[model samples]
Target: MPPAHPFDDDKLREECGVFGVVGVADAASFVALGLHALQHRGQEAGGIVTHDAETGFNQARRIGLVRDNFTSPEMMARLPGPIGIGHVRYSTTGSKGQTAIRDVQPFFGEFAMGGAAIAHNGNITNALQLRRELIERGSIFQSSSDSECIIHLMARSMGRNIPDRMEEALRKVEGAFSIVAMTRTKLLGCRDPLGVRPLVLGKIGDGWALASETCALDIIGAEFVREVKPGEMVVITAEKGVESHFPFRPNRSRFCIFEHVYFSRPDSILGGRSVYETRENIGRELAKEAPVEADLVCPVPDSGTPAAIGYALESGIPYAMGIIRNQYMGRTFIEPTEQIRNMGVRLKLNVNRALIKGKRVILVDDSVVRGTTSRKIKEMILDAGAAEVHFRIASPPTAWPCFYGVDTPQREKLLAATMSEEEMREHLEVDSLKFISLDGLYRAVGEAQGRDDNAPAYCDACFSGEYPVAPSDMMEQGFQAKTAAE
Candidate 1:
C-alpha cells in the first residue's frame, strides 16, 4: 500500500459517494461525469456498474481519481448500458491500511429475479453482529466490507421482488445510510430513517439521476428535484418515472452538520440552503460571537476560504490569501517516512510572507481535529513574521468520533476530547483560539432559534457527544458513551 498524503491525515473523511442514472444513452458516461464532481467525498477508489439489454451487467473498478481511471475510451466502452450506478470511496470498513479491488463498490450480486448493483454511503452500526449471524447460517462472505452484508441479507430475504428484499434487509440494519442501487432497467435511491447522509433526485431530458450531493447533478446539467426524504425509497425507470415508498418508520431529519462545515462541495445546496452561503454565515456568526482585533482575516486555504470571507466582511478587516495551496497535488505525492512526513504541509501549502509579515492575522478554519496541522500552520505564520495568530474555527470543537459514515479518529486522539478551550489555546501556542458556539453554528445553518436540546435539527454528535442512534457495535467492544454525571 502507498503512504497517505501528509495534509489529509488529520482531516475527517466521508466513507463514500454514490451516483446513479436511469434512461440515458451511454449511461456510464453520465455516471463517470457525476463521480468526477463528487471526488471530494471519497478519493481512495471508485467503481461503476452498468446494465445493457444485449451485453448484460458490466463494471469497472479502479484505485485512484475518477478522471485518472474512468475517462479512457476503453473503460467507458466496456460499460455499455442505459442504466448505471457509480461509487467513489474511502474505506471505513474492510482493510484499514489499503483498499483492495474486492472491497471497491458498487458491489454486484445475483439475486433470483436478476442481478443488482449497490453503492452505499454511511456506516451500518450493527454490521458486525449481522455478519456473524449470517456466517453462522451458511452465508458465504466475499469482501470484508459492512456493505456486503446488505447483499447477503437481501439474498436470504423471502420477499417477492428485489426492492422488497432490499427493504427487508435494511429493516434489520441500523445506523445512517444513503444508498443508490440499480437493476437491469431500474435505478433506485433510499435514505435511512434519520437522513444522516444526503441523497438527492435530479431530472434530465427523459432520464433521472440520484447523487449524494447536488453538485454532481449540476455537472450533468440536470434539474434539481426534491431530496429523497428520510426513510423513503424511490424506484425510477425511463418509462414509469419515480415511485416513492417508506421503508422505515418516519423520523425527524438529523443530517450531518459537518456537511455545511467541511464535507459537501461549497457550490452544493443542503436542505434548501447554499453550503457556501452557510460557511460565510458561520464566519459572520463567529465574528459576532468571538471577535478579535486583528488587522487581516486569512483562511487556512481552500476549505476555510468562504468562512474567512464572511468573517472579513462582518469584522471590517481585509481578507487575504495568507497561505497558498498547490492545486495539482493529488492524494499521494511521496511515500512518507518519519522525516518526509514532516514536510507534508509545506509541500501542500506555503506561507505568504509578504502579506503576513507585520500583520496581526486571524485564521479562519472549518475545524481543528488533532491539532497537528494547526500547530504546524501556526509555526509557519510566526516564522513568516506575523505579529499575532488567532484561530477562529467555523464550528464547535469536535470531541467525539462519528459512528455514521464519516471516518473520525478515536476520542483519545482528538485534541478537543481531552483539553478545554484555554488548554488547547496554550497547546497550539496561538495568540487566541475561539470556536463558534454550538448555538452559533446552528444559527449559521438556518436553525432560527439555534439547536433545540429537545429536538436538534442536525446530527451534532461530534460536538455534543449525544448520539441520535446507538453505536451498538462500539458498545459491544466496550466503548463507553457520555454519562449524565459527566
Candidate 2:
C-alpha cells in the first residue's frame, strides 16, 4: 500500500515544476538548487538530466525530495555537464506505487536527429486520446505519464531540428503546458498558447535559466529577465545565445489565477505582480465585501498567513496565532488513506487554547474544496473554548475541477458544487462563511475595475465555470461541465 497522507487532502495540488540551465559549470547542481526552491510545487519525486560533450548524457531520477535525493556530492559528481534540465513531480495521470518511478521525469528520448530530455509542467487534456492513437500506430511507451506523449510526438515529427520537431509535436497536443527541454547543445523552453502555466527566463553569470517560477531563479542568484511569452519557444545555445520562435498561433494569455492565491511561493513574482501582495489584496477585498466583528483574526497558518495579516489590517481586528503548525509535517493531503487523512489535521496543526479561549475568532484560509478541513478545524477551535468562529475565504468557492494541471477532485466531491455560502457555514458549524467575489479576486490581482466579462484578465474557471480550454479527453470520457450557482 502507498504511504498514508496525513495532510490537508481537501486542497488542490499542482502537478509539477520544471527547471533548465545552459552554459553553467556543474549545471546539474544548479538545476538541483532550482528544483529545491520549487519543491513546494511537487514532493513525490525529482529528476535531473544533463549532457556533456564527452560523456553525452547523464541522468539522476529519484523518488523523494530534492534535498534527500540530489544533495550528495557523489550524486552531483555523477551528473557533470554544462547543460541540464530538472523536474519535481506529483503524479496527476500515472499510478502511485513503486512502478510509478518509471514516470518520474526529465524523460529522455533519442531521435534520428539527436538526443533530448524534457521536463514538463501542466496537463495535456487530450493526452489519452493521443496516446491511444500513437499506440495503435506502433509507438512503444516507457511510462504511463501524460508527458511521455510529447516524446512520442517528437519522434514522429517531420521537422529538421529538435526545436522544430518540438514545435511540431506541441501543435498536436492540447491543454496547459510549460516545458523545459535539454539537448547536447541547447536548452529550450516553451509555454502553451493560453499560458495556463508559468515559465520565466533568467540569467546567471554567462548562463541562461528557464524555470516555472522566479523564486527558483533567485535560489542560484539568477537575475530575472522576463517570462517566456505564451506560444513562444526559446532555444539557448552557447554559440548563438538565445533564439526565439513562435510555434503556435498567438492567443490572448489566460494565466492561471490560482498561482497567486495558492500555488506559488509568496516571494515569487508572476505577471509583474508579487504573489504575496496579490494575496494580501485579496484579503483587503474580502474585508470590504464581508465585514465581520470579531475579537481576533487568525490564519490557518502558512498558506493563509499573508491574507490573514491583510484581513486584520483592513478590519482593524487583532491578528494572533490561534493555531500553531508543526514545522516537520509535510503537507497532510498527500496521504493515500482515509484513516491517515482523518489524523492529518491534528498531526499538522494544533489549536492554541490560551489564545483562542473565550475569543470570537475569524479564520482566514486560501480556499475550501471539500469542506472536510473546514469542518475539522471548526471543531478544533470550538473545543479550544473559542466563543464563535467565522470563516473568511480568500478565493471564491472552487466548484469546478481544473483540467489544466491542477489536481482538483471530481465535481460531485467539491462542496461548492452542491452548497451555497450559508449552506457551507451550516455544514462546517461556523458562525458564518464568506468567499471573495469573482470580480473582487480580479481586482485583488490588479484589475482595478474588476473582471471584464468579455475578456477576463485571468482564468477563474474553478469559480465561474467558464473554462477557457475545452477538456477534450474528459468530454470524451463522459465528464460534463457544471453550471455556476447564483
Candidate 3:
C-alpha cells in the first residue's frame, strides 16, 4: 500500500457538510447558499438536489467550492423546487471509489420500494460490515463512502415509506453521523446516537431548514431554533409542520470535542457551545499549562491563529503574524508533486522577519499529525532569525484513528502517537515543545459549558486512546495500510 496522507500536517480535515431545506421557492438556490455558508467545512466538492411535485427532481454537483460551483446563474437555471438537500464532501475514505460525481452527494438511488437521496456528515464505523452483507445479498455499490451504505440499507428494507426504511437503516449502521436526506415529498434529518457531529434545525418564515452549523441558518435569513438532539430523527413535510422521532434511546451526548478545538468555523455554534469561546479556552488553558517567555506569540496559520490570539492575551504577550497563508490557494491546488507542494509552502506562507528576528517566539498550532509541514515551518521561522521557537499545541496528541468522520491516519504515522513529547520536540527540532494536557483540554471547552469537568463526554478519542466506535473495515481499507507507510 502507498503512503496515505489521511492526516496531513497542513490541517486535519472535517468529514462533510450537510444542508437541507423545505417549503422554499428557490429550493436549489437556497441550498446552494446554505452550502456556501458551510464552504469552510469541506472544499473537495459541492452538490445540491431539489424536488418539486411538478418537475420531479433535479440535481447539480461538481468538484469545487460552493461559491465556484453553484453560482447564482447556475442556481437560477436549476429546476425550481420546494424541497432540497445539499452536501460538501471531504474524504474519510479517499480511495478513488467515491471521488466521482456519481459517488458524491447528494447520492441518488431508486428501488422497488421507492427512491431517495442522502447527504451525510460523519463516518460510519460499521460501514464495511454492512456493505459486505449488502453485497452478498446482491446490493450494488456506487461510491466508496460509508455514507452510501445507509442509502442501500434504507432502499433494501421492507418499509412502505421513506421514514420507515430510514429508521431500519439507522438501526443497522453504527458510529457517528448527522444525515440529511430527501425523498420526492419530504425532507429529513437524523443524528447518530452519540451525536459525534453537530446538526441543527432552523426556520425561515414558513419554510424550515437543517444544517450542520447555525452559521448556515444565519446566511439565508433563517432563525436559529435549536440543535437536533442525539439519537433523534426529524422529518419535515408539507402536511406536517415538523415531526420528530428518536429511533435510538438517549445515550451519552458525546459531541466531538475537536469541533470546538478545531473543526467547526469560529462563527458556528455546536451543541450549545460557541466555537470561538472553545478556541479561546484552549488558548487560555495553553497559557496556564505551558507558560513561556517570548517576545511574540505567533500562530502557524488560520486555524492556529485564533488560539494564538487567546494565548497571547492570557500570557500578556503580543501576538504577531509570523507566517501568512495564501487565502487564494485551494486545498487541491494543481501541485502535482510533494516537492511542488513543499515549494508552494513559501507561496502558501511567508515569514515576516522584522517581527521575529532577534525575538524568542512562542509558536501555537492546532495539532501535528505528521512531522513534514511543521518541520518546514520551524525552519522558515529559524531562517527568518527567530532567536528561539517554543512550540505550544492547543490539543493533546492525535495518536489514534477517528472512527467517526475526521480523517486521522493510523497511529504509527502520527509523531505524537508513537513518540513522547520530548521525542517529538527533537523530531521537529524546535527549541522546546508542550501540548495542552488532556485534563486542560476538557477544562477549556468544559468551562464554557459551566461544567467543572474538562470535556463533556464528546469524542476526544483522537487526542485520547478511547474511540467512540472501532474503525470499520471501510476505515481500514481507506486509511490503515496507507497511513502505516507514511
Candidate 4:
C-alpha cells in the first residue's frame, strides 16, 4: 500500500475492533462477517482464530481490509472451528506505517491446559513496564505490540486453568482493554475495570457472540444481549452459555464518549441509546451553543451527515449535500506522485459546485484533529464559489492524545493543543468555527443535567486531558498530565 489518502488520515483512528462467536456452524465464517462490519475500526490488518477437536487451533492473519483477506472460500477453509474470535487492527501501540504480519492479532499461544487465541482492543498503559520486567525474568516476546503482554502474562501465571490464568495476567496489567479470546471449546470476553473501551454480548440462534460493538453482532444476525459490564469477564461455552465473573476491583464505569461522536457506526446502539440519535443530539447542542446564520447546512459526507441533518432541522436552514464523497476512492494508493499527492482531499471528496456556488455554507464535521482536512475542505468550498464557509464540530476540542486505544497525535501535534478557537478559525480561514462544549456533549449523550465534574460518566480524556488510568508508560518517558489549573 502506497499510503492511506491524507484525506482520511488526519482524524483520530480507533485502535481496533474485535468479534467472537461460539456455538455456530463454521464459526470462522461468521467471525469474518463481523470483522467486515468493523473494518472502519481497523483497516490495516485482520485475523481470525478458530478451534475444533480435529484441527485444534487454526488462524490466518493478513494485512489490509477484512473483506479483502477473510471473505474468500479458500481463506475461510483454512480456519475451522465451532468457537472462534477475530481482530481487525489499526496499531495504536506498535509500528505505524510498516506494520508486520507478526503484529497482526488474534494472537495464538499454547499452554498446559490447551491452545488459546486472543484478540484485543485498547492500549496497555503499563505494557512497557511489564515487558521489561517479563524480559528480565526470561519471558521471550514474539511481536512489538503492547497487546502481546497479555499472552506473556498468561504464560507466566501459576493459576489452575486458562480462565484463572487470564485473570492473573490481567490483574497485573493496567489501562484500557476489551479482549475476545477462544479455547478449543470456549469463547472468552472481558473489559477493563473502568470499562474505558466497549465490549458487548449478543445471542445468535443457540449460540452467543461477543463484539466490540453491537454493529458487528448485527452482521452475523446476533441478538444484542447486553454489554459485558465494567470489570466483568465472560466465559462462554456451547453447553453452559455464558458464565460471568469480575476479576478486578470494583470501580465506576468510564466508557469512551468518542464512540458516540465518531468511532462507531451511526446505526449501532451504545449505553442503550441510538448512536445516530446521539450524534444528531450533538448537532442540536452545537446549534444551541453557537448559532450561526448561514444560507445552508452541509455535512462533510458520511460521518457528518447525521449531525448536519440535526443542525439543519434545528436552525431551520435548508440541508444540502454540498460536498459529495467519491464512494469508490480506494483507501490505499499504488504510489503518491507529486500530481496525485497535491490533489489532497479532492481525491476523496468534492464540492457540489452547482449547489454551493452562491450559498453561505455551514459545514458540520465530527472533529478537528490536525486541521489539515478542514483547511483543505475549506479551500475546496471557497474555490467552488461559496460565499462563506462556517465550521461546526460535533465533539469538544480534542486537546489531548488518548492513551487508552485511540490513535491520536502527540498533544502538541493536535491543533487544539496549541491554538485557541479563534486562532484555529483564522488558520483554517473560515468565516467562523465552533465546537460543542463538553457539558453540551454530555447532555447530547443522555446526561440531561450535563457532565458531573467530580466523577464524569464517560472518559473524555482527549477533550478534558484527565485520564482515568494514569498513562504510566508516557509518564516514564517524562510526559506530565495536565493539572486542573493548567
Per-candidate RMSD vs. true structure?
1.0, 2.1, 4.0, 1.0
- Cα displacement (Å) at residue 377, model 2: 0.9
Which sections of candidate 4 miss by over 4 Å?
332-334
Give the 10-residue window scoring lowest on summed lDDT in candidate 2: 1-10
lDDT of each: 0.93, 0.91, 0.82, 0.91
Q: Candidate 3 local accuracy as lDDT?
A: 0.82
Please give the lDDT score at residue 165 for candidate 1: 90
- Give the alpha carbon lDDT tens digit for every residue of 1-486 in model 1: 552354557778766899999999999999999999999898888999999999999999998889899998989999999999999998887877688899999999999899999999999999999999999999998899899999999999999989999999999999999999999888999999999999999999999999999999999999999899999999999999999999898899999999999999999999999999999999999999999898999999889999999999999999999999988665566666778766758878899999999999999999999999999899999999999999999999999999998888999999999999999999999999999999999999998899998899999999999889999999999989877566
What TM-score does candidate 3 reach?
Answer: 0.92
Q: Per-residue lDDT tens digits of candidate 2, residues 1-486?
A: 242233667788866999999998999999999999999898889999999888899998998789889999999999999999999987777765342778999999999978999999999999999999999999999898999999999999998989999999999999999999988989999999999899999999999999999999999999999999999999998777789999899899999999999999999999999999889999999999999999999999889999999999999999999999988775333544677656758877899999999999999999999998889999999999999999999999999999988888899999999998899889998999999999999999999899998898777888888888888999998988644453
lDDT tens digits by residue: candidate 3, 82-106: 8999999877764641366665788
- CA displacement after TM-score superposition, residue 184 of candidate 4 (Å): 0.8
The positional error of residue 50 in candidate 2, measured at the CA in angstroms, is 0.2
> Evaluated with lDDT, which candidate comes out highest?
1
Please give, for residues 1-486, the per-residue lDDT of candidate 4 as tens digits: 533444456788877999999998999999999999998898889999998778778889998888788888998888887889999988898888777999999898999988889989999999999999999999898899999999999998998989998999999989999999988888999999999889999999999999999999898889999999999999999999999999998999999999999999998999999999999999999899989889999999889999999888889999999999888887664356778778888988989999999899999999999999999999999999999999999999999999998888888999999999999999999999999999999999999989999999999999999889999999999988988897
